[model samples]
Target: MIYFSLQTPSIPTLEETQAVVQEVHQDLQQLKPNAILETIRSWTPGLLSFSYRLLYAAIIIIIGNRIAFYLRRFLKRTFDRMGMDLGLSKFLISLANAIAYAIVIFMALEKIGIPSTSIIALLGSATLAIGLSLQESLGNFAGGILILVMRPFGIHDYIVSEGVEGKVLNIGLVYTTLLTVDNRRITIPNGTLSNAVITNVTAQEKRRIDLTIGISYSSDLKKAKAILERIYREDPQILQDEPITVYVDQLADSSVILGSRGWAATEDYWAARWRIIEKTKLEFDDAGIEIPYNQMDVNIFQKTIDK
Candidate 1:
């Protein structure tokens, strides 16, 4: 059998390294600027090609911008024809223009020779990051969109939601503003309002007024009901088409509670309600009907034995 020896190369000492560096420095004197000139010469042919691409991209961007404007106008007209809210229509138009411009920008970028796939990836990542950070705001924004589109309630409509009762003043992107009966303004997040139990009082043409009154047990139930019904009939604002309902709803410890329901035009609901409340007391007084109150009798036993 023959044995083969494998020898390792020895490392260069300091002197050998210095000598190599000196030799490289001497060779640098003979080198020219040919490498830079060659690079510029090689790129000269592509310059015209790149310039043309840039010019084409510019033209595309300009034409796309004009198209975006035209689309905005067309969308506005379409939305108006479809009976969309005016403010919402404007917002949608602006959004459409933004999307159009973004698409044009990406196309232009691709024409300029940048890879569109990489740009889209970068945009997607950025959008994901922004979306995570703005989840709550985005939810409110989405809720606003739903409200605008569905129109659950409109401006000046009286609504009750989340234990707050008020007239809607403005419906904005992130929040809804209301004016309370006392004329104080309050704003609620659209997200919360969208999920809440919304009671729109004036959504219908006619409104119902409910009033409750109490009288002594001795008073005639039939007469009391008749008086309430008459009051509802007398009110001009109260809609006569719908039937008025009055009944002895409950016999409480203090009095017989009569519940009255009357229908009125939406605009006259408050007037009818106030009139009924005021006239009930006057009618009962004239009829000598007593409105009962809580009373307790304390009988003191004679303390003669103790005395």
Candidate 2:
């Protein structure tokens, strides 16, 4: 037979237990301030580095903006000296300014710890998305470039396209502004404008004025032609170097149509035409020439009572 021996564990008194707890609490209280100081010391360098970076970023932005402004001013002066087309010069200046600002922004971002490569990748993605979504706008931008290169029309040119007639106010990247004769502003997409039939009224140095005058068949054709030729010769705006032609154009049922053609300076075209028409009317009346009009004669007979 085997036997085992055991002993009961000793239990501490209540006063002893309370004294131990008090001792531990006092030890923790003594270490708390040291722990707090250690934590602050560990974070100090990182915090200071972040603060310096933020301040540097701010300075970069400020300096970069100033440089961009000066650069834009310089470009404007250079373009003025070169006598560049207004539309093309404006477009190029704006494009340069945008590029400068983009560079400045990327520099600021890099100072704040953002990588330029990452930014470029993000921009690439964004540009692809935008290009897909704004295809028409991109087309308009391309059209603007074409307009600047080909030079179909220029600033202040009076043009008629897509049924809209106006003076070109500005040609931007995506839209071309027009100021109508009535002082209304119209904005047209450059893409549409580039594709349409553009009639530049003031493109030439001189324009022709063609007028058709109708007189009674009984009127003397020779006299009408002679009067028209004389009027063309007397008009100061009509260019004497150009050929003037007046002839009988058509013979209708009740009237003979006389056609007159004369050349005038582009700027004087409207005034010259108006003056010629007014003088022709006055002179024709004075010469006893009858301008025919349609007239219907009504006859009522005894047949109406029979009906």
The most accurate candidate by TM-score is: 1
Checking candidate 1 for backbone clashes, the offending pairs are none
* Model 1 per-residue lDDT tens digits across residues 1-307: 9999999999999999999999998777446466667888999989989999999999999999899988988998899789988878988888888899989999999999998899899999999999999999999999999999899999999999978989999999899999999999999999999989999998999988989888998988888888889998998888888988998889798899999998888988887788889999999888878888778899988766754
User: How many backbone clashes does every candidate have?
Assistant: 0, 0
Q: After superposing candidate 2 on the true structure, give the runs of residues whose Cα lies further than 4 Å from its correct spot.
A: 1-84, 90-122, 304-307
Q: Considering every candidate listed, which one attains the maximal lDDT?
A: 2
For model 2 the local lDDT of residue 81 reads 95
The deviation in Å at residue 183 for candidate 1 is 2.0
Kindly report which residue stretches of model 1 are placed more than 4 angstroms away from their true locations once superposed.
1-45, 250-254
What would the per-residue lDDT of candidate 2 be over residues 45-116, giving only the tens digit for each residue? Answer: 999999999999999989999998999899899989987777678888898989998998899889999998
- Cα miss at 15, model 2 (Å)? 42
